[model samples]
Each structure stands twice: as structure tokens, then as C-alpha cells.
Target: MSNASFWKGVLPAITTPFHADGSVDHAFLAKHAVQLVDAGSTAIVPLGSLGEAATLSFDEKVAIVATLVKAVGDRVPVVPGIAALSTEEAVKLAQAVKAAGAGGLMVLPVYVYTSDWHEAAAHARAVLGATDLPCILYNNPVAYRTDILPAQIAQLAGEFANLQAVKESSGEIRRFAAIKELLGDRLVLLVGMDDAIVEGLAMGAEGWIAGLVNAYPVESVQLFELARDGGYAASAELYNWFLPLLRLDTVPKFVQLIKLVQAKVGLGSETVRAPRLVVEGAERADALAIIDHAIATKKA
Candidate 1:
């Protein structure tokens, strides 16, 4: 409701809907964006991890961002992910996202198989420097192995006013608290881990960049609202109910699990790009059962 640059609330890293043939399903993706917005997400992030950013080509990513911007049509802010392996490419993608009418950018650390934090910070600054749009630093150490430490984030935030937010996915609540303590109200703190959203928000996180929100936007937003309203007990109840489904998004086969949950909800197909196989038979059934149980329990 507010036009804050990066306030705390629910922002779904929307799953990239794919056709059965493994091509970007633009039609389904557009519809899925609308579904997420209508279901209650304050923002939508296309081309995120759940969106299978690594599997998509540069042009495909651009097209997806464009489509989401057009589909969302001002319903919610669309912050596209820019996870290129190179700094130049990341900047180029950020420009593309800006041109596509994205509200902001979520940048993951370059996946160049290195542990250079300075290089990572430089790359992030380069990307943000090139774009006038606001940027959210994505700190997913498990995926990038380069944790954007709280001090580094404070430096980045101080250096770039447009470095408006940081999505902490380190699974460390203390790290979230540390960032809050270091930066205070200077930077927007968004929780990337679904299970930690409530705790993070309780500790001054303003929003959530969640993958599970792709399938359960209503429940996710409800949890966020409860937390925002100081209803920790109620928020915990919803969170615990959805914990199993949310945990599925953390597994090695996260893309597979997200798609499976989408398919189970009849929101989209369970298709992912190559090298990332779909969960089938037992795994697929298990994921679906978890999703079904969560939905049923929440409804009850």
C-alpha cells in the first residue's frame, strides 16, 4: 500500500512457469504472476532461484521480466533477479530489467567459482552503479558460497543509496539481527528463508523475498501480516503448518519441488530446464502430499 522503496512484506520469488517441452511458458507465467499478486504478495520477483534463473538464457530472462511487468500492470512491484556469472553481464541484465519496467533488482553473487568477497562486492556495486533503479543484495551463502557479511552490506548500503535492501538467506537469524543492528533503518532487510520470515520480521526485517510464496501466497502474506501486527503466536501457528512445504524449497531439488507444488495446486506445470529433472513417482507424490496437507490444515 505504501510506496516505500523496499519495505517489509511478502515478495514472492515467483516460479518461472515452463511448457512441457521445457520452453518458457509466457502465457502461464503471466497468469501465474497475476495469481501471486491477487493472492496477496506485495511484490513479485521473476527469474529468481525458484524461477530457474541459471537454466534460462539471457534473452529468455529478459522476456520473462518483460512479460511479468506487463502482466502485473502496476498491481505490485516486479523486482527481477539478475544472477549473471559476470559483472558486466549482471549490469547488462539490470539495465534490461529496468527497461522492462521492473521496480528493482535482486542480485545474487556471481557464480564464478571463487570466494573473493571484494570481487563480489565490486560486482554488486558495478551492477547497482549502472542502474538508477533500487537493488536488493541477495545473500544466499549456500548457493554462492560468498556471504555478503553485515559489514560489507553496510558499506554497500552507505555507498549506494539505491542498494535499498538485502535479502538474507544465510539461515542465520543472528546474521539478520546483526545486519539490523549495524544498519538500523538505513537498509531494508528482507528474509529469503521462508521458515525464518517471522523471526526475521520480529527482529526488524521489513519484507520477505520468499520462494515458497510461489505456491502459498495467501498463507505467506497472512504470516507476514500477523508478524507485522505483533501476533507472533498466530504467525507461528501458520508457519509451523506450512513448515514442511516450505522446507521442500531448501532441498537440492528445490526447483523440482517448487514446480511439483505448483502442479499439485493446478497453478502451473511441473517443468524445469535440463540438468534439473522433475521430481517423479515417490518424490513427486511426497511433495504433493506435503503441499496438500499444508493447504488442508491451513484451510481447516
Candidate 2:
């Protein structure tokens, strides 16, 4: 595939399904991948933060990507996340996922390390060099506490031909304009946050690296298309209705909240790994209420 516009559009950062005992549910994972494609997802991104990549074992990550690739049958791209704390680990991850049949990777910065832009650039170089597959550099300063600045990204783009896009989740929509001004057509910009899509797209974001798409794939797909196709009025209408549920993607308990919504929609189980429990009490009630309200008031 060509580098241009191939990585553009709605790519859902899919959740990793776990069994009651917290084991990786490979069977259901394949089924879920197929379901996402059928629901109109442009591509599938497994093993992302939404998928709890930090908690998964190496073997499990490979299996998940392999299962997703087999299930999707190349109907859409399957890009898994590569989040590592060291250059060696990240390179290993990129190589392993490429071997597992992933079309590309959503590469995040070194987690928990708080590296500066130069260190981030070096990390990207090592990881991008390890695999020939296309990559989307994830820049979520809010979550990772390290900014992958526009200048650094432009430098990486100049050095690595396979660095095709950026998941711009800085929560400042104006960063889109800054990156666009600097990189121009060098990198396709994808909005990373769920709540920021409406304005982000308005600010020249080419697509969405969405989190809530796991539970509401149809709406997510439609939202991206409407916005990209110049249907801003319609997209904004849908986005406003989706705002309440989209806000759930930004919270500390987002994994639990999204899993609960997915279960409510009959997509998957609400089981999370140890140290991260399923949503309960007022949090669960609030999530349920938002979901129910959105469902009841949904419009085309």
C-alpha cells in the first residue's frame, strides 16, 4: 500500500477481551475483531492503551494480533500498539508484531520514563528501524507526561519513511494546526481523544484514533466519515449526543467504563486484569445512565 492516505480515517483502539479468570480470551477476541469490521470500523488497533497493553504478555500480544489479522481477513488494516519503556523492548515489540502479521503499529513513547523530545526521537528511531511496517507515532502528553513536540515529529518523519502518521492527543486542538504548519503533508494527523474529534477534525485532523469506538463502532465510523466528508453540521449533531459517553474515555476508570458499556452492548465481557477492577457503585451507575441516554436519544 502507498504511504499517503492509507492510514487516514477511523481506526479504533480495540480493547483486549479477558476471560473470567483474567486469561486472554483468544476465541472471543477473534469474534470481536470480525464484529468490529462488520460494524464499519476502517481498521482495528489491538493491544493499545485501551487494550491494556501494559498488562498483556508478549505471547498474548502476538496471539491477539494474529487472531485479529486472521479474523479480519485483510478486510481492513490491523495495527497493534507498541508501548515499551526502553529502545530494545520497543524494537523487539515492533519486530514481533510485524512477524505476527500486523499491518502497522501505533507506537507510544517510553512509558513511565518521562523522557524529553530528543530521547523520544531516539526511541522512535530505534523502534521504527526495527520494522519496515508503517507506524503512527502516538503523542498523548496528558496520559504519558512527555510531549512529542511537532519539531521532533517532523525530524522523525524526515528520518523514517515508514512513520506515516501521528495520534495527536495533547487535548490542545490548536496543536493540530502547529503540526500541520510544520509537517504539512509529511504526516497524516489523527485525533487521539474521544471528546476532541469534533473540533480536532475542524482544525485539519485527517482522522480519529478513537477510544470509545470499541463500544460504539457504528457511531464512531459514521462520525469520522461525516466530519471528513464535509458534513460538519451532521457530525457535530452526532458528536454532541455522543459527548456524555465520549467523556468516559478521558477518566481514570476508562477501561472499566468502556468494558462495562461493551458488555451492556453484548460485545464482550467486563472483566479487567488485577489491580483494575470492573466499574461499580456510582461510577457504574453513571456510565449506565449515560449509555442508556445516548441509546434512547441517538439519531442518524
Candidate 3:
């Protein structure tokens, strides 16, 4: 399928669900993908930052994509994030997931190493050219120290036909307008940060690579539709109540926080992989306050 307009709605940057044994939970994984799509998510983005991509092994990541593909049934795109410490590994996974039935790919900066545009370009170029699958460039300067500026995004967009979108997660609303000013719809611009969704949309972002969506897919989509159709003022009340919980997606411990919310709503468990533990102590208490409050007073 073509990548045009692929970034049109809330594409969940889903959290990885782990079993009590710490194995990937394929059963819940499949069920969750279909549920999100049915709730109005435009696509399924697995093995992303929100999915705890760093902790996953290569084979585990591929299997997750395969499970999501089988679950979604080609109804919506399954765009797995292609990220590895090495360009070769990233390219290898990109091809594997493409064969596994991924509709598209989201290219991320190489793990753990920050680099200049020259280095970043080479890595992105390798992955973008790896497969002809439509690609979305994942730009989160905060998480991955490498920042692909708007002009650099234009550079890649100009060179790669498959690189059709940019997930702008710089946490600055101006980046959205900047990308639009330079690319002018050449690349579908999407907000990668949850707290900035409204501002990003106000600045011409067509979609959101949403984190909070995994817990509240219905509300996330409803909010997106409301804001998209009726503007910010119309969506303020709901967005206001949702804001406290949405901020959880911006923190470093976001994966655990989002998973906790998912667990609270009975959508999934709060388990996470090693190198990262589930939120505990005071963090869990504070997070639950927000999660429970939102659930208590939620609106469509």
C-alpha cells in the first residue's frame, strides 16, 4: 500500500506487554492492536520508544510486528519502528518486518550514539533506502540525541520517495509549523509527543504518534476528531481533563506510566522489560492519582 495520508489520525506508539515470566505477550499484543484500530487509531506502531524498543531482541521485535500484522488484517497500517545500534542491523530488521507484512516503516536515529547531520543522514539514508516500504522519519531529539532539523528533513524527503512522513517529537510546537513551512505537505507531519497534540494540530500537524492512546484509544480518537473538526476551543474541556494524564507520556519513565494507565483501565498489564522497571513507590502513587481521576471523570 502507498504511504500517502498514512499519518491521518492517532497512530498509537504502543507499549510492549510482557508476561509475568518477562516474555513478550503475543496474545494480548494481538488483541490490543485490533482494539486500538477499532477504536479509531489510523495505524499500529510497534517497537517504538513507547514500546520499549531498546530492551527487545531482534527476533522478539520481528515477532511483535508479525503478531500485529496478523491482528490488524491489513485494515490499517502496521508501521514498525526500524531502530538498531548499527545501520546494518536496522536495515536487516526493516527488511524482515516488511516481509512479515508491515504496511510501512518508521525510521529512527541509531541507538546510544549522537551524531552530526552527516552521520545521521548516512544512517537514515541506509534505512530509508533499505526497503521500498513507505517510511516515516522518527525525530525525537530528546530521547535520541540526534536531531534531524526541518531543513534536513526536507533533504531526506527530497531524496527518498518512500520517506513520506516525519514524526516530530522535539516537544516544541514551532517544529510543526517549521516542517510545514519547508515541506508544504511533501511529507505528512505528525506530532510524536502526546502533551503537544492540540498545539501541533493547530500548527498543521495532520496526525499524532500518540503514547496515551494505548490506554484511552476511544477518547484519544474522539479528541483528535473533535479537535480536527471543530478546532481547539471545542476540544478544550476534554483536552483539559486529559492533560494531566497526557503529561505522563512526556516523562522519561513514560513506558511504565502508560502501561500503568493501560492496566488501570483493564486494557493490559503494567509489566515492562528489564533495564526499566514498572513505576513504583511515590511515582506509582502520583501516576495512579491522575489515571484514576481521568477514568473517574472521562468524557467523549
Highest-lDDT candidate: 3
Tens-digit per-residue lDDT, 111-229, candidate 2: 78998877878887888888889899999888889888888888889898999999998888888999999989888889889998878888888778788888888888888888777
Candidate 2 C-alpha error for residue 24, in Å: 0.9
Candidate 2 off by > 4 Å: none
Poorest stretch of ten by lDDT in candidate 2: 1-10
Per-candidate local distance difference test: 0.82, 0.85, 0.90
Q: Report the lDDT tens digits of candidate 1 across residue range 1-300.
A: 222645457888888877777788899889888988888777888888888898889999989988988999587778988888788788889898788788888888886566677788888888889988777889988877888889999999889878888888988889877887888877788888877777888888888888777777777788788887875786777777888988887788988887777777777777788888887798777877888887677763
User: Which regions in candidate 3 have their CA more than 4 angstroms from the true location?
Assistant: 1-3
lDDT of 1: 0.82
TM-score of every model versus the real structure: 0.95, 0.96, 0.98
Worst 10-residue stretch by lDDT in candidate 1?
A: 1-10
Better of 1 and 2 by TM-score: 2
lDDT, candidate 1, at 58: 92
> For residue 185, what is the lDDT in candidate 3?
79
